[model samples]
Target: MGRSIYCVVTAAGSGTRLGHNEPKALVNLAGKPILHHALCGLEPLGDLAGVAITAPANYLETFTQIAREAALSYPWTVLPGGSSRQKSVYEGLKGLLSFEPGNGQLPANDPTAIVLIHDAARALTPIAQFERVCQAVESGCPAVVPATELIDTVREVKGDTFTRQGLKITPAGSTPDRSRLRCVQTPQGFAGDIIFAAHDRAREESICEGEAVDDAVLVATLGHEQYFVPGSMRALKITYPLDLKLATWLAENPDRD
Candidate 1:
């Protein structure tokens, strides 16, 4: 029997970059909200043990309505989010703990239970990508994330100064080998106990808001190695206006993938 799997969708981001007054997850993509698309993508994983969505406190009702309409098979609820993404995720993890059977923490006898932390903005992440992350965790890898190779040249710059003479270029920067760099994506998978412990430690340390880039970074900070698997380009996060438009186009034309 497979261990139980739970998901926490971080949908509390303000869509300032997307130029929307509402939360990014509430923004519509091809008639349905982005959160709807995100939840639908998780359906292929079979019935989840629990699903928690962290959204703005003010819009909890709105998110609740959306989740109800999505009609997912598993149990789910909307949670009030915190000021920062890191805090929001922390809250989501806590919410999951409340739902887990027994002491609201990982059961020592069953360490195979897994948790997937995903970004709601990445509405189009393929079901296959979710499966890959889950498989890696079930295979005994404590931490796993999906990533794609960077095709662009990356440079490390020390400093830059501007001058009236057509902006002087500084030679203090050097190009790093792009071959070793991989652009990471979510849903990042982790053993239930591992993520719970990581979040608990971060809170106790009062880690600055947004200090860790992603859940994987927090896990890595605890000195755990993260395994990587290939991710789909279609899983791109919806941020800028152009990205929203492109995602809409992609949704309308499924044959393109």
Candidate 2:
């Protein structure tokens, strides 16, 4: 009676900061393209119930080529992304509608089907993380996001320079506790209806709910049940050109491989 799980891979960015003319997802992270590594995490998931790709409309061919090279023979849709990250996500959601409900689209029976949304930059999303999210989905939670603990010292900047701007101790006059707060990461999973509704609310209200570029934060504000599952530091997002160096190193390393 439960809805099936689907994964959405968002890769629709122009690598402006990477200083490359190519799409950010297509930038080679190692022997393969960055998005290739991203989808590798989902490779072992039995080819996924449905797969959605959001990339630059101009470079959909490039994404298709990468998908071919990756040997992904799953039922997938390539949707042209939007101008902003949110817009791109919406575009991916709309594209998923083309499929037959669980094949990737929204099912009438499983309105609350689990929809795992992940950024196509984090190539190393561990299988354990994906497994945990599926478990969370089974618990009937509205959303489940991977998050890591903050063991490092926390700081709150007050001014332009550390000299001009001394630490502001979170207005409590002492270092704020991070024992509870978590630094969330992607591969965030959610119920399809709940997630779509949350984003739809934001679109209707025209308000910024969360600062993070990820979408789960926007859903969390809706007062629905949201849980955090264990995450891996190995799941790194390829941002700069140098990040690919680290990705390659990890991929090539005998231990990491």
Candidate 3:
């Protein structure tokens, strides 16, 4: 068997773009909530040890009920998330590490254990991608994130300042080679101890404004090299209403792309 895997799925986003009253995770996708679809994506990981889900403080019960409805075969918990995604993921990591085994005690912390950090908004991620990430981590990749090359022409803008009309004035600067750039996606996998330490370091240092950085960035700051695996277009993050419409169509046609 490969390394045992744990998951911390962040679902506290208020889907203002989805224009829904509920949190993004609670929005309907196909026949179930977006969070349900995300959990289902992890079902293919044969060594999934446990899962921790973080949701809006007021919606903990609703999230728990949805998770139960998913009928997951592995141990899982739903808890209140922090104000930001990074904080929420840290909370999830703590919650997952504290999970009680069948013997009623916290399992010993295994440095080599694998942890996957995923977003509930990426509900359409294929199941095989989860296993691919875990396998990469198990194969000795300290940090692994699924990424895809950017196809469209990219441009850099300089002189970032608000215009008199309240529109940010970003004049076009230069075009960077698209071949060197990639759009990253999650369930980012990492060695358990490494990722946990990285998060703890991030918390202690109070890096950046509002902790807007992702786990991969945190790991990079810690000087750990990260490996990239092939990401799927199906793993699109549902952000705006148009994205949701596309996701709805993709849900109906899972075999495409």
Candidate 4:
């Protein structure tokens, strides 16, 4: 039998960096909310066991409404998220525990079950990347993440210099080999039990809320290696105002691929 897979979209981030008054997920990409585009990518995965979305406490209703409007066939629910991204993902995983499986209910330890944790801010992530991650998980990889090779020279910085704008400029301390570097992207896939245990262990160790940048990082802390798959440029994370503009262009030009 094929494995059961679930997805958790973490959409609770405040858009402070994006300079928006609303949550990043609620910002529009095309004519719809960024969360809408994120969900749309997952819609093609017809066999998804279930879905969970973590939204800001105050915006749960708004996010719920958007999910309902998407009219997905899979069972989905929105939960109140925590103060930080890591905590929000943990909350999403906690909500997934209640998901009803096809066999009846999810077992306490289902090694065959897989889960994908995605960032709602990456509104343009391709559906193919989602499939690639799932295929890797099904092929026996416990942890998988999509990544893109870096095209620019990346340098490590040391001493800081000040600008009139108060922005500190740090001189390059050293340049790492770009061939060994990759810019990672989301919809990181993992074995359901493994991720649940990782999160539990993180809590027991009192890991700070935002310390781990991604779930894969937490899993790596548990000593598991993550396999990487090719990620599309269209999957760029929308952060600054320019990112929003780029995402908007991609949204309007779906045929560019």
Error of 1 at 126 (Å): 0.3
Model 2 regions lying over 4 Å from their true place: 1-3, 102-109, 161-174, 209-212
Model 3, residue 24: what's the lDDT?
Answer: 96
Point out where model 1 deviates above 4 Å. Answer: 100-110, 160-172, 208-210
lDDT scores of the candidates, listed in order: 0.85, 0.74, 0.85, 0.87
Q: Report the lDDT tens digits of candidate 2 across residue range 5-67.
A: 677788987777777888888776656778888876687764256778898888888788778
- Candidate 4 wrong stretches, greater than 4 Å: 103-109, 161-171, 208-210
- For candidate 4, write residues 1-257 as lDDT tens digits: 26787888999988889899999999978899999999888888846887889999999999999999999777889999888888988888888877767664453237788889999998889889999999998899989999999999987878765678978776658899999999999999998888988888998897655568889999887898999999999999999999999999999999794
Among residues 3 or more apart in sequence or in different chains, the pairs in candidate 3 whose N, CA or C atoms overlap within 3 Å are none
TM-scores vs. true structure, each candidate? 0.91, 0.85, 0.92, 0.94
Q: What tens digits encode model 1's per-residue C-alpha lDDT throughout 61-126?
A: 999999899888877878998888889888898787666463343431235778999999999998
Q: Tell me model 3's lDDT, rounded to 2 decimals.
A: 0.85
Backbone clashes in candidate 3 total 0
Pick the winner on TM-score between candidates 2 and 3.
3
lDDT of 4: 0.87
Worst-scoring 10-residue span by lDDT in model 1: 102-111
- The worst-scoring run of ten residues by lDDT in candidate 2 lies at 101-110
Tell me, by lDDT, which candidate is best: 4
Q: Order of all candidates by TM-score, from best down to worst?
A: 4, 3, 1, 2
